[model samples]
Target chain A: MDVQTWTYLLVIVTFALYIGIAIWSRASSTKDFYVAGGGVSPLANGMATAADWMSAASFISMAGIIAFAGYDGSVYLMGWTGGYVLLALLLAPYLRKFGRFTVPDFIGERYYSKTARIVAVCCALLVSFTYVAGQMRGVGVVFSRFLEVDINTGVVIGMVIVLFYAVLGGMKGITYTQVAQYCVLIFAFMVPAIFISIQMTGNPVPQVGMGATLADGSGTYLLDKLDGLSTELGFAAYTDGTKNMMDVFCITLALMVGTAGLPHVIVRFFTVRRVRDARKSAGLALLFIAILYTTAPAVSVFAKTNLLKTVSGQPYAEMPAWFKNWEKTGLLVFEDKNGDGLIQYVSGPDNELIVDRDIMVLANPEIAALPAWVIALVAAGGLAAALSTAAGLLLVISSAISHDLIKNVLKPEITEKQELWLARGAATIAVVVAGYFGINPPDFVAAVVALAFGLAAASFFPAILLGIFYKRMNSKGAVSGMVVGISLMLFYMLKFKFGLFDGGKEAVDALEADWWWGISPEGFGTLAMVANFATALLVNALTPPPPEHIQNLVEDIRTPEGAPPAGSH
Target chain B: MQLPTEFCRLSGPARMFTFSGHTNPDNMDQPTRQEHATRYWNANLRIMAVLLAIWFAVSFGAGILLREWLDQFRIGGFGLGFWFAQQGSIYVFVLLIFVYVYLMNRLDAKFRFDR
Candidate 1:
C-alpha cells in the first residue's frame, strides 16, 4: 500500500482504539473523574505518566533538535530526565500522601488560605495553556504533512477527539487512553530507529550502534566520521558544544525544576493508590521514558550522518523521490548558486539547500528507505503523543476551574453532581480555547512554551517545596514569594524573548549583549527560583509562624503511613 | 541536614499536637510517638541528601563543569563527558529513583509505618 493509505488506516485504527477505551472507562462521579477512583496500579500509572509527560515536543521535535544542534542539545536531554529524580525523591510521594485532587488543593490546604489557592490556580492555568498550545500546533503540522488536510481542519479534528474523552471520562479516560498512546508512540519511535541502526552499523541497538564502527569495514567509529564530515562542511564538531558553560548550567537546572513543577505531571501521582505506589510509579515512568530518551541521541547521529552523505556536494537533479516530496511541503529547498547544479549544504553563506530541523525525525524512515507502513506509523504516533498530552493539560485547566474555583471557593456548598457537570463544561470550553490557539498560533508559540517551563519553575516549585519541607512556612510568605517569582520571570521573558521593551522580535538577537549576567531568557528561571526561595525565607522569618494544626499537617505528610484514598477528604 | 534538626528544636509548640491521641492505638506516650516520627524524618532526609549529591555530581559536575577534562577519555567511541550528557546521566537518574523507592520502603517497614 501507498504511504498515504497506510497513514489513513493506522490513524483511523488508533483513533478508534482511543475512543473505545474512553467509552469503556467513562467516569461516573467526581472521584472517578478527578483521580481515576484512586485505584490505578503502579505500572499502569507509570505508562500513563510517560505518555502525558512526553508531549509532541519530546516525541517529534527533540531528536530533530539534537540532530541540528549536536552537543548543545545535551541541555534538553539532561534537563528533562533529571527532573524525574526531583519528582520521585522530593515531591511525588508526599503530594500523594496529601491525597489531593489538584496542585492548588495542596497549596490551599497546606498554607490554610484561599488567596494562596487562587494564585496557584492562575499559575497552573497559564502554564498549562502555553504548553497545550504547542501540542495543538504539533497536531496540525503532522496532519497537514501526512493527511493532506488543512492545518485548521487537522486542529479541529484533534480538538474533537480530546474533548470527547476529557469531558466524558476525565482523568480515568485520559489515563487508559494515554496507556494505549504510550504503546503506540514508543513502538512507532523504536521501529524506524532499530531499522536505521541495523542498516548503518550492523548493530540492532541504536545505543550501541551509535558508538560502533561503520558496517562498511572502514574501521571508522560513527562519531569520529560524523565529526570529520561536520568540520569539512564548516560546521562545528559533532561532540563539541559552542554554548558557554554557565548558560548550559542554568538552562539544565531550569528545565529540571520546571519538569517537577508541572501540574499535569504532578496530578498523575494523585491517581495512584499509595505513597509507595507514587514513588514506584515515578520510577517506572522514568524507566519507560528513558527508553526513548536514550535512543534519541543515537537517532540524531544516524539522521545527521545520512543527511550529510546524501546531500552535500551531490547533484540536485539526482536527488531521491523523498527529497521532491518534502520540497513540495516547503520544508526542503534547493537552489543553484554560482550556476552550479550541485547542492552545497555548508553552514556559511553560499549554501544552496535549506533543510528544516523538523524533517530530520519526520522524514527519517523515508531517508533510510524503510517500508511504507513504518512511515505511516510515525504519523499515528505523533498524533497519539499530541492528543494524549493535550488531554492531560486540558484536564488540569478544567479541574482548576471546576474543582478549585467553583466547587471549593465560589460555592463550597455545591453538590457532587453539580461539580461534575461544571467539570465537563469547563473541559469543553478549555478544548475550544486550545483549538483556537492551535489554528491561529501566536508568532511566539515556541518562546511561550519555553517560558511556560520558566513560569512553573519560578512559581510552583518553590511553593510546593517549602510547603512540604518547612513547617514554619505561612500563607503570607508563600503568597508573596509566588507573586515575586512569577512577576520576575514574566519581566525577563518579555524583555529578552519577545523583545517587548527593546523594539520587537527582530531586535531580540541584537539585544543579547544587554542580558543580565549573560543569562538568556530561557535560563532566567533558575535565578527567579533562587529569588523566590530567598524572599520566602526572609518573609517567613519576619512573620509569625504557621499555626499548630498546619505544622501537624506537614508532619503527617512526612510519614508514609495511612495515606487515605484520594478525594476521600 | 542540620536544618531539619534546627526546625525540630524550634517546633516545641508543635509537639502539643500529637498523633498519639488518634493514629497510635498502641497506648504509646506522646513523647515516644513524637520521637519516632522525628527519627523517621531524619532517616529519610539523610537518604535523600546522599542520593541528590550523586544526582548533581553526574549531571552538573561531570557533564558540565568537568566536561572538557573528561573528554580526554573515551568509553567505546563516546567521549566520557558527552556520553554522560546524552545517555549515562539519564540511566543513573532512573537508577536513583528506584533506589530511593527501595530504601524508603525498607525504612517505612523498619519504623512500623508500612501499613
Candidate 2:
C-alpha cells in the first residue's frame, strides 16, 4: 500500500482510540476533571505522565537537536531526566499528601493569600501556553507532510481532536489516552531506530549500535566514523564539544529545575492514591521516559550517519527523491555556492544546502529508505505525542483559569457542575489560541519551549520549593519572588528574541551584544532563579512571620501522617 | 533513618492524639504532637539533603562541571563525560527515586502512617 493510505489508516485508528478513551472516561465532577478522581494507579499514571511530558519536542525534535549540536546536546538529556529525581524526592510526595487539585491551590492555601494564588495562576498559564504552542506546531508539521494538508488546516484539526478529548474527559480521559499514546510513540520511535541500527552495525539495539563498529568490518567505531565524516565536511567533530562550558552548565541547571516545576508534570502526581504512590509513580515515569530519552541519542547517531553517507558528495541531479521532496517544503535550501552541480553537506559560510534541524527526525525514515508503513507509523507517533501533550497542557491552562481563578478565588460559591462547565469552556479557548500560534509560529517552537522552561525555573520552582521545605516562607516573599523572577526572564527573552521595547532594529542590535556575562538567553534563567531565591529569602527575613495557623499548615503538609485519602477531595 | 525509629517509639500510646476520651486519650498533648512533627520533619530533611547532594554531584558535577576532566577517559566509544550526561545521569536519577521510595516507606511503616 501507499504511504499516504497507511498514514491515513494509522492516524485515524489512533485518533479513534483516543476519542473512545475520552468518551469512556468522561468526568462527572470538578475533582474528576482535575485529578482523574485521584484514582489512577501509579503504573498507569506513570505512563500517562510520560506521554504528557514527552510532547512533540521529545518525539520529533530532541533527536534532531542532538543530531546537529552533537556533544553539546547532552544538556537536554541530563537536564530533562534529572528533574524527575527532584520531583520524586522534593515535591511530588508532599504535594500529593497535601491533596490539592491544582498547583495554585497549594500556593493559595499554603501562603494564605489570594494574591499569591493569582500570581501562581498567571505563571502556570504562561508556562503551559508556551508549551502547548510547540505541541500545536508539531501537529501542524506532521499533518502538513503526512496528510498533505496545509499547516493551518492541520493545526485546526489537531485543535478539534484535542478539544473533544480534553473537554469531555478532562484529566481523566487525557490520562488514559496518554497511556495509549505512550505505547504508540515509543513503538514508533524504536522500530525505525532498531531497523537502521541493525542495517548499519549488525546490532538490533540502537543504544548498543551507537558505539559498535560498522557492519562492513571497518574496525572503526560508529562515533569515530561520524567524527571523520563531520571533519571532512568542514563541520566540528561530531563527538567533540563546541559550546562554552558555562553556558552548558547553566542551561542544563535551568532545564532540570524547570522540568520539576512545570505544573502539568506536577499535577500528574495528584492523581495517584497516596504519597507512597506519588513517589512510586515518579520512579515509574523516569523509567518510561528513560526508555525514549536513552534511545534518542542513538537515533540521532543513526540519522546523522545515514544523511552524511547518502547525499554528501552526490551530484544535484542524482539527489534522492526524498531530498527534492524535502526541498519543496522549504525546510531544505540549496545555493550551489561553488557553482558546481555536486552537493556539499558541509558546515561553512559557503555551504551549499541549509537544512533545518527539525528535518532530521522528520526525514529519518526517508533518509534510510524505510518502508511505507514505518513512515506512516512515524507520522502517527508524532501526532499522538503532540496531541497528548497538547491535551495535558490545555488541562493545566483550563484548570488554572476555572479552578484556580474562578472557583477558588473569584466566586467560591459556584456549584461543582458550573466549575466543570467553565473548565471545558476554558479548554476550548486554550485550544483555539494554541492553534493560532501553531499556524503562525512565532519562532522555532522548541526554542519557545526552552523559554517556557526558563520561566518555570525562575518563577514557580523557588516558590514551590520554599513552600514545602521552608516554613518561614510567607505570602509576600513567594508572590514577590514569582513576580520578579518571571518578569526578569520575560524581559531578557523579549529583549533577545522579539526585540521588545528596543526601538527599531539598531537598539535591538546593540542589545544583542549586551547579554550578561556571555550567557545566552536560554541560560539566563538560572541567574534569574538565583535572584528569586535571594529576593524571597531577604523578603521573608524582613517581613513579620506568617501567623500561627499558617505555620501549622506548613507543618501539617510536611508530615506524612494523617494524609487525607487520595480521592477524598 | 533515625526518624523512623523515633516514630516507632513515639507514636505509641503515650504520644497519640485524640479528639475524644478514647484509648490513651488522657496522654494526648500538644507538646507530644509537636515533638513527633519536628522529628518527622527533620528526618525528611536529612533524607532530602543526602539525596539532593548525590543528584547534584552526578548531573552538575560529573555531567557538567567536571565533564572535561572526566572525558579524559572513555567507556566503549563514549567519553565518560558524554556517557554520564546522556545516559548515566538518567539511570542514577531513576535509582535515586527507588531508594527514596524504599526509605520513605520504611519511615511510613515505622510511623504506622502507611495506608
Candidate 3:
C-alpha cells in the first residue's frame, strides 16, 4: 500500500483500540474517575505513567533539537530524566501514603488551610493549561501533516476522542488507553531508529551504532566524522558544547525539579495500591522512559549525519522525492543564492537551505527510504503521544476545578453523584478550552510551554517537598513562598523571553546578553525555587508551627505501613 | 556519617525489646511509639541523603561541572562526560531508585512498619 493508505489504516485502527479500551474500563464512581479506584497494578501504573510523561515533544521534536544543538542538548537529556530520582526517593511514596484524590488535597489538609488549597489549584491549572495547549497543537500538526486534514479539524477530532474517554471513563479509562499508547509509541520510535542504525553503521543497536565506524568501510568513527564535517562547515563540533556552563547547570536543575512536581505524573502514583508499589512503579516508569531517552541522542547522530551527507552541495534538481515532499510542506525551503542551483546547507548567513527541526523524526523513515508502513506508524505514534499526555493534563485541570474548587471550597455538601457529574462537566469544558487553544494558539504558545516547567519548579516543588519533609511548614509560609516564587518566574519569563520590558519578540534575541547571572530565562526556575525555599523557611521561623495533629500526620506518612487505600478517606 | 552506627545500635536493642514481650505495637504508650517513629524516620533520611549525594555526583558533577576535563577520556567513540550526560546518569538513576526501594523495604521490616 501507499503511505497515505497505510497512514489512514493505522490511525483508524489505533484510535479504535484506544476507544475500545476506554469503553472497557469505564469508571463507576468519583474514586474510579479520580484515581482509578486506587487498585492499579504496579506494572500497569508504571506503563501508564511512562505514557503520560513522554509528551508529543519527546516523541517528535527532541531528537531533532538534539541533532541541531549537539552537546548543549545534554541539558534536556539529563534534566528530563533525573527528576525521577527525586520522585522515587523523596516525593512519590509519601504522596501515595497521603492517599488523597488530588495534589491540592494534600496541600489543603497538610497546611490546614483552605487558602493554601486554592493557591495550589490555581498553580495546577496554570501549569497544566500552558502545557496542554502545546500538546493539542502537536496533535493538530500531526493530523494535518499525516491525515491531510485542516489543523482545526484535526484538533476537533483529537478533542472528541479525548472527551469520549476522559469525560466518561475518567482516570480508569485514561490509564488503560495510555498503556496501549506506550506500546504504540515505543515500537514506532524504535523500528525506524534500528533500521537507520544498521544502514549507517552496520550495528543494530542505535546506541552502539552511533559510536561505531561507518558501514561503508571508512574506518573512521561516526562521531569523529561528524565532528570533522561540522568544523569544516564552521559549526561547533558534535561533541563540544557552546552554551555557558552555568546556564546548562540551572536549566537541568529546573527541569528535574519541575518533572518531580508535575501534577499529572504525581497523580499517577496515587492510582497504585501501596507505598512500595509507588516506589517500584517510579523505577519501572523510568526504565521504560530511558529506553527512548537513551536512544534519542543516537538517533540525533544518525539523522544529522544522514542529512549532511545527502543534501550538502547536492543539486536541488537531483534531490530525493522525500526532500521535495517536505519542501512542499513549507518546512524545508531552498533558495538559489547567487543564482547557483547547488544547495548550500551551511551554518551561517550564506546557507541556502532552511530545515525545520521537527522534520528529523517526522521525515526520518522517508529520508532513509524505509517501507511506507513505517512512515505511517510514526504518524500514529505522534498522535498517541500527544493524545495520551493531553488526556492526563485534562484530568488534572478538571480535578483542580471540580474537586479542589467547587467541591472542597465552594460547596462541601454536594453528593458524590453530583460531584462525579461536576467532574465530567469540568472535563468537557477543559477539553473545549484546550481545543480552542490548539486551533487558535496565541503567538506565545510555543515560547510559554517551556515556562510551564519553570512555573511548576517555582511554585509546586518547594511547597510539596516542604509539606512532606518538614513537619513545621505552616500554611502562611507555603502561601508566601509560592506567591513569591511564581511571581518571580513570571516576571523573568516575560521580561526576557517575551521581551515585555524592552521590546517585543523581535528584540528578545538581542536581550540575551543582559541575562541575570548569565542564566537564560529557561533556567531562572532554579533561582526562583531557591528563593521560595528561603522565603518559606524565613516565614516559618516567624509563624507558629503547625498544629500537633499535623506533625502527627507527617509522622504517619513517613511510615510505609498503614497507608489507607488511596481515596478511602 | 554517624547515623548508620547509631541506627544499628538503636535497632539492635529495639528488636530485642520487641521480641521479649511487646510484639503488639498498638498497645505501646504514646512516647514509646513516637520514639519508634523517630528512629524509622531518621533511618529513612540517612538513606535519602546518601542516595541523593550519589545522584548529584553523577549528573551534576561528572555530567556538567567536570565535563571538559572528563571529555579527554573516551569510551568507545563517546567522551566519558558526554556519555554520562546523555546515557550513564539515566541508567544510574534507574538503579538508584531500585536500591532505595530495596533498602527502604528492609528498613520497614526492621521497624515493624511493613504492611
How would you class the docking of model 1? medium
Report the lDDT tens digits of candidate 2 across residue range A24-121.
Answer: 99999888899999889999999999999998999998999999999899889998999899899889998998898888988888889999999999
Q: lDDT tens digits, residues A168-237, model 3?
A: 8999999999999999999999999999999999999998888788999978889998998888888899
The iRMS of model 3 comes to 0.8
TM-scores of chain A across the candidates, in order, are 0.99, 0.97, 0.99
Cα misplacement distance, residue A159 of candidate 1 (Å)? 0.8
| CAPRI category for model 3 | medium
The runs of at least 3 residues in candidate 3 whose Cα sits more than 4 Å from the true structure, single-residue gaps closed, are B1-21, B24-31
Clashing pairs in 1: none
Interface RMSD of each: 0.6, 1.3, 0.8
* Estimated TM-score for each candidate: 0.96, 0.95, 0.96
Give the alpha carbon lDDT tens digit for every residue of A1-569 in model 1. 99999999999999999999999999999989999999999999999999999999998999999998888899999999999999999999999999989999999999999999999999999999999999999999999999999989999999999999999999999999999999999999999999999999999999999988999999999999999999999999999998889999999999999999999999999999999999999999999999999999999999999999999999988999999989998999898987788999898898889988889889999999999999999999999999999999999999999999998899999999999999999999999999999999998888889788889999999999999999999989999999999999999999999889989889999999998888888889999999888898889999999999999999999999999999878
Candidate order by decreasing DockQ: 1, 3, 2
